[model samples]
Target: MISGSIVAIVTPMHADGSIDWEALSRLIDWHVEQGSDGIVAVGTTGESATLAMDEHKMFIKACVDQAAGRMTVIAGTGANSTSEAIELTEVAREVNADACLLVTPYYNKPTQEGLYQHFMAIADAVDIPQVLYNVPGRTACDMQNATTVRLAEHPNIVAIKDATGDVARGRELIEAVGDKLAVLSGDDATAMELMLAGGKGDISVTANVAPAAMKAMCDAAIAGDRAAAEAANAPLLMLHERLFVEANPIPVKWALAEMGMMENGIRLPMTPLSEGAQPQVREALRHAGLLK
Candidate 1:
């Protein structure tokens, strides 16, 4: 039941690549006002890869405290390491996050059985609702449908964020285990279609800039009102496609900054949005009516 437009929110930063705690608070408040069903703090879009361990822990705690039950705060605790993932999930649990999202082990390319053990290990270690994340494109690790269905048996494992963008396969996964767990779409461009096909909702990067529209689309889609969902999603189609014109968050963080929501302060290794891609991103926002 943890459904609807869950934003994989970016961690707002100062121009010097430092966390902008004040901006973070403001953004969370905006989502609450805009009707986002939930948020995944420190997720991939939040630049989790570069955060110090203490920063990561504090980031999740801050989001949870700020949200204050106005909306679901799902801590993004996934790591390439199982123990690290467990430790992060434990932190989420201690801080009272609604759920923790754990991506499949990356870089090591663990086998299917290895993937199973890795997730099962974490579910065993943490007594909290857990959501699986499978973005093979980013992780070079794909959790097959069978493995996901197998993991669904664990009472604590409640959902999976399917970023594969394959609606056909997503439908298969839903039919296989939709009764046991929610299959949330992790890819925004195809999220509405997947939801119409039975996805519970989306973990959206696009929602960072257009929460109300995304929430409206999700509300319609989840309610089986395809016409309404399509109308709500039409304006955001460009946002969904353009947000990734560069790498993630790069375009999205820039979009947010353009809207005067936050500073355009991306971390090193991930620089500010390039001058070339800026125009299209701007047009995307304009098309969505998020900007004039």
Candidate 2:
């Protein structure tokens, strides 16, 4: 299972926006040391849009190599195009990634049937494990319960990263197909609730800055310890809401830099956290005890 606090890691870049492999390796080591059970490189949080295909593949391969079996590495190999998605997934399998997180197609909104065929094509195309990423907020295309259940029948499509933040929908999906597939939360704000309601884990952005606390929350909730889970949840309560004050990786990347974990550099169109937005995010970090 791709369960627990899996950081949707940031792509550490130089001040000039170049990939910093040394920093990248250090970040990986830090996550594993902080007790992150998995690393999701080149996902949305990693600024995947700005990275070229080769760069994406290189990043994934490097993370897999660095992890070296210490933790699961789930490559973000999603594309709006079926053929492109298949190619990315194939490259992920070649790198020996444990699984691939395939997000819904963006820009080109597809019907439910199209969604099914798209994932079906990729699942059939690749022999490796596949986890469907249904982040309707990002893709503007939601994969309903039926579409997911249809794909769930495919053995290779093992799980889901549900970023919808709709607890009811998550519960329904779990009730309908929890036995067939693991439903992982992609949204941090509702991770604990989703877990209590039957989510397997979180594909978390907050985990990048506070892995231990986040992991503790997931572990407690999954173990049926509500009070302990809520106690662990206190520090994360702010992070659950503030990391998205602007756009993801903006506040998060800046938070990591504040903690001296990584450079705050971000690619074009997605700049660093706004000067105005810093104080609140910093306070959230302070509340979480990640910063002062």
Candidate 3:
């Protein structure tokens, strides 16, 4: 089981918006040193939408190579087109990624049946462990608990990153598919609650800046230690909320740059954290003790 705080790490980029391999390596090493349980490379937060196919493959391969077995690497291999998704998953498998995280097809807004078939087809095509990512807010396609439970029967479909942020629904999914598929919380603010209700871990945006604290909270929550988990999470509430003040990766990438972890280089369509939101993110970072 790939559990605990699996960081949905941002792909470090230069001012010109090109991949910064050196900064990426440094970030990977820092995560390992900081006790992050695993890393999700080229996921939504990694700006997978902006990266070209070649760039996507390169980032995944680079993360796998850099981690060098120190931690699990779950590559984001999702596409609205099933064939494209299969191709990406094949690449992830070829590169020996620990697993692949596939967000529900976006834009097209496939039905539950379409969702099931799409996932089933990918699982059938690739033998690698797969984690289904269901963030309706972004994808516009919500994979309901029933559909998720149905897909859980597939051996390769090992987990689901539920970003719905409904603790009640999350608990229900865990109860239904907990034994069959690991239910990982994809929403940072409600992650500890989901974990306390039998979730395995979090595919976290917050972990991008405060990995050690996220890991500690996950560890405590997974171990059923509410007090410990709450203690670790209390300081992060502001961060959990503020990082989304702008679109994702916008605020998170800015947070990383503010902490001197990366350059302030967000791609077009997604601008740098606005001047107005900068202080809010900075204060959140300071509250989390990630900045001075």
Q: List the global CA lDDT of all models.
A: 0.95, 0.92, 0.96
Tell me the tens digit of each residue's lDDT in model 2 across 1-292: 7788899999998878999899899989988898999988899999999999999999999999999999999999999989999999999999999999999999899999999999999999999999999998888999999999889999999999999999999999999996889999999888888898888899999998899999999998777788998999988889889999998889998998898977888899898899999998999999999886
Query: Each model's TM-score?
Result: 0.99, 0.99, 0.99
Error of 1 at 149 (Å): 0.4
**Clash number for each model:** 0, 0, 0
Evaluate residue 32 in candidate 1 and report its C-alpha lDDT on the 0 to 100 scale: 98
Off by over 4 Å in 3: none
- Judge candidate 2 against the unseen true structure and give its global Cα lDDT, from 0 to 1: 0.92
Q: Which portions of model 1 show Cα errors greater than 4 Å? A: none
The predictions' CA RMSDs to the true structure, in order, are 0.6, 0.8, 0.6
Tens-place lDDT digits, model 1, residues 1-292: 7899999999999999999999999999999999999999999999999999999999999999999999999999999888899999999999999999998888999999999999999999999999999999999999999999999999999999999999999999999996899999999989998999999999999999999999999999988899999999999999999999999989999999999999999898999889999999999999999999
2 versus 3: better lDDT goes to: 3
Clashing pairs in 3: none
